[model samples]
Target chain A: AQSVAQPEDQVNVAEGNPLTVKCTYSVSGNPYLFWYVQYPNRGLQFLLKYITGDNLVKGSYGFEAEFNKSQTSFHLKKPSALVSDSALYFCAPPTNTGFQKLVFGTGTRLLVSP
Target chain B: GAGVSQTPSNKVTEKGKYVELRCDPISGHTALYWYRQSLGQGPEFLIYFQGTGAADDSGLPNDRFFAVRPEGSVSTLKIQRTERGDSAVYLCASGSGPSGANVLTFGAGSRLTVL
Candidate 1:
């Protein structure tokens, strides 16, 4: 039962404000975490990943995530929110089965108001 | 060619009918994967292919679902006796390596609606 959880169903932020979409994991050993975003009617696009190295990983579209081992969390964050950034985001961590299969979280919807 | 490509972007069919969704991975990619996404859920792993062989099919829900990667380039996911619950977007992704460290490139996905 290794899995990732997105506690929030939706997060709202005013444009130009900082925003955070939370994610937590339940897994053994050092985890490789990933974040993906899906716009309406489009497939998911990779945002960023944490494999090993700096806890702060930068991704596309000015998005970044901080991997916190103590809290077992890898939350997606942005310094300035944009209405264009609003979409569905998912937190994924690889399954322990030794395969490349990723176990994805339910997903969090981010909405930035103008 | 440019990226992971899927065919029949949308499909609507009656229950109990058979459906086939195809995927063509990026050139030179050795790993291919299939995932299903429901209305409000994240993409769920369905199968994984390493070259011409199926490295893992454990995520497939039942025997009704089957997939094949003939010649190690293209893949087709087949569903028999389709149920309404089977309606979801089937996504195909490809990676350059066999390890989880490789970032996957996903296709737009094939939306299947079982009536």
Candidate 2:
């Protein structure tokens, strides 16, 4: 089964500073990685995806992620974090072998200090 | 175009009571899915509907839980004899294609509370 792991339960970052949320995955075939964010009482919003392209993919709100095949990791990063960026982040892998499903991470709470 | 929408943002029902949650997928979406999310946990798949047929129902916990997308547009998830453990947010999502590569757009979930 395909799965995603986010080692950190929570990450606190100072506003205007760089921030990164790590994500790693285990899958059988070519991986389709995704990052989503959830604010209070809202649905999960798509941030970015790594289908097949340059290892670096940019997404909403100046957020970007690096897809490292060797490391099997897709880490979300931002050059300068904002207080409004604080929310729950989830990393998911889209599995296509036999079963077409997305395995989501446990979620990491991000706190940005002003 | 409008995004996926779910009805009854908050529902509180007594234990063992029947409950129904509705979802309206995006216009012309070919796939719809139902998932449940407990507090502090990620969403778990419950069922998936392709057009008017249920392509996958294996994720359903028991016979008490059933879902139908009669028109391939709107879907209803019904739960009979709901238990306290069933209390969670029920989320609905729709994507344009059946492939895992398709981006799924989700709705504001229906928060179900079994009292």
Candidate 3:
């Protein structure tokens, strides 16, 4: 079985401050982790993915995720949060035992206040 | 099309009605996926297709839910005896290359409302 957990239902950050949305996963073998963002009434947009190699993966909109093997975590981060950065963030791993499909977390709502 | 496209952007129907949703994957994309997203939750995988064949459908909730990609280009998801619980936004996505990379291009989902 493969699954992901996003502990926070919502995360609040001030504009210009760094923000982090936590994610953890359970997988049988090497994991492929991903981050997606969804705005209201819109489909999800791919942010970043961690396949292998470097622990830190940079993505669109000045977002990055750090994959921690020991911790089984891949937390999304941004150095300077903007109000436009506010959206729903999801953590996903390959569905089932393979990499064809994806199983997503419950998602965390990010709010960047000005 | 430019990206994955789903038809019937919004649907409202009563329980027990049959409904069909359609998806048009990106040109040259061999892999397509269907997912359902409930309010306040992330999208849940429903099915995956590698060309015209259904590579995996383990995520489908029940036998009443069926999908086909006969031509390997466009796909349709048919739901029989729709129930209130089936109401959710159905999303479609397309990707290229091997399944390992799993990079998908998504479409604005079709919102289904079952009353």
Candidate 4:
């Protein structure tokens, strides 16, 4: 079945340090990957997406994701972590079934300490 | 509106009762979708609507979960005989273009709790 996986349940980073939230997908064809963030009591907010373009894609709040086809990975990254960045991150990729439905990962919680 | 809007931010009810959640998509967005988010899990696709028709309902868990978009702008997700297991956050999102390339704007969501 086509799906996306977030290997880490939680990631911890100190303020001013770089951070990475890993995501890998298993799909039949080319995938359109997306990243969303959810703060406490808030809905998921779109961060970035990779359709067909350069491997690197940047998004809001200084967030970026690198789409690596060979590795079947699209990991979210930030150059410097902020305490405000602590939230739950999800990686979503289109499902094999025709339509716009997305298959989302379990999610990764990032904790940034000041 | 500037963003997708959902009503009844929180709802608590007894098991076996019925519930309805409403969603108002962003102006001019032709595609709307509904998803459910369980505790500690990612959002799961429930249904998708293209204009006034349901293009896909494969993600809906069962017949009891029904969604309708009559005018193609607002939608209502209705649950029949709600159960404790159905307690979750119902999310609504809207997109302007085709599925693969479209970026969805989501609402705050309606939280439902069944006792």
Candidate 5:
């Protein structure tokens, strides 16, 4: 079974500062990890994904994620945060094990204050 | 082309009423997905369609929830005998290729409220 966990319920950051949203996973084989953002009354927007390759993966909106096999973690990061970046962040384990259905975390609310 | 689209941005119904939510995927995208998001929670997978067939429907809460994609372009999710517990946002997403890449584009979800 593939599953994801985002420990924090909410994370607070300031505009122009660095930001990080953490995630970890549990699966039998290699994992496909993803990061998505959801603003109020909107659908989730894909941020990044790590399937295979280097540990560091860059994605849309200047976002990036680091995959650590030993730690079973894939964390989303950005060098400079924006008030516009404030939203709900979700970490998901790709649904690839026969079913191809993703299992998502509880979501972490990112509040980037200016 | 346009991104994935969903119909009836908001749907309100009584507890026993039935409701159907629709989704139109990208022109050539073959993989489509349906998920449910409750207040303060992340989206939960309900079903996934690979072409015209339902490849997975494991996340569906129960038999009351049904979906179809006969033409492989547009799809509809039907919920019968809705309950208060059914109140949530129904989100639809589409991705390109069979690999189910990380490039899943989502539609503005349909908000369903059961009274």
Candidate 6:
């Protein structure tokens, strides 16, 4: 079974500072990794994914993630955090046998202080 | 629908009662998925549909949980004898491909509360 682990339960960062949400994965035969964000009372929104490409993958809202096969990590990063960037972040691995199901991490709540 | 839509944004049911949650995936999306999100945990896979058939149901916790995706668009998840443990937000998602690499659009989710 493929799984993702987010060690941090909550991450606190000051506004305008760089932020990184750590994610590590375990799977068999090259796995797909993804990052999703959730605001209060909202669904998980797709942020970025690593399928097959460069280690640096970028997604919505000036966010980017680095996929490190050696480290078994795909940590989500942003150059500068915003107040609005505060939310719950998740790291997931492919859960679909063939139909795109996702197995997600416990999630890390990001708190950006203004 | 513009995005994956789940009905009854909030559902309140008594323990041991039965409840049904609905999901309407985006039109033209061939893959539909159901996930359960506990209070502090990330969403966990429940089942997935490739077209009108359940391609994978291995994530379903027990026999009390059942899902159907008739007509290949809308899906319904039926839970029998719901327990307090079953209380969580039920999420629905859809993707353009059957492969796990495809991006999925998720719904706001139906918050299931078992009293």
For TM-score, the strongest prediction is 1
Q: Clashes per prediction?
A: 0, 0, 0, 0, 2, 0
The 10 consecutive residues of candidate 2 chain A with the worst lDDT sum are: A95-104
Clashing pairs in 3: none
- TM-scores for chain A, candidates in order? 0.96, 0.94, 0.95, 0.96, 0.95, 0.96
Off by over 4 Å in 2: A97-100
Question: Model 3: C-alpha RMSD to truth?
Answer: 1.3
lDDT (10s digit) by residue, model 4, range A54-99: 9999999999999999999999999999999999999987776655
Question: Candidate 3, residues A1-114: lDDT per residue as tens digits?
Answer: 878999999999999999999999998888888898998888989999999999999999999999999999999999999999999998888865454677787899999999
Q: Per-residue alpha-carbon lDDT of model 1 for A1-114, expressed as tens digits?
A: 468999999999999999999999998887888999999999999999999999999999999999999999999999999999999999998887766798886799999999
Report the lDDT tens digits of candidate 5 across residue range B1-115: 4998999999999999999999999999889999999987778999999999988888899999999999999999999999999999999999885574547889999999999
For DockQ, the strongest prediction is 6
Better of 1 and 2 by DockQ: 1
For candidate 6, the per-residue lDDT at A109 reads 96
Q: What fraction of correct interface contacts does each candidate retain? A: 0.73, 0.45, 0.71, 0.71, 0.59, 0.96
**Each model's DockQ?**
0.79, 0.61, 0.71, 0.74, 0.63, 0.85
| Tens digits of per-residue lDDT for model 3, B1-115 | 8988999999999999999999999999999899999987788889988888988898999999999999999999999999999999999998984476678888999999999
Which docking band does candidate 3 fall into? medium
lDDT of 4 by residue, B31-77 (tens): 99999999998899999999999988888999999999999999999
Candidate 3 residue spans exceeding 4 A from truth: none
Residue-level lDDT of model 5, residues A14-80, one tens digit each, is 9999999999888878888888899878999988888888999998889999999999999999999
Which 10 consecutive positions of candidate 5 chain A have the poorest summed lDDT?
A93-102
The TM-scores, one per candidate, come to: 0.97, 0.97, 0.95, 0.97, 0.95, 0.95
**Which tens-of-lDDT digit does each residue in B1-115 have in candidate 6?**
7998999999999999999999999999989989999988888889988999998898899999999988999999999999999999999999997887899999999999999
lDDT of each: 0.94, 0.90, 0.91, 0.92, 0.89, 0.91
Which parts of model 6 have CA positions greater than 4 angstroms off? none
* Comparison by lDDT, 3 against 5, better one: 3
DockQ of prediction 6: 0.85
Interface RMSD of each: 0.9, 1.7, 1.5, 1.3, 1.9, 1.1
lDDT of 2 by residue, B1-115 (tens): 4999999999999999999999999999989989898999987888888899998898899999999999889999999999999999999999887887788899999999999
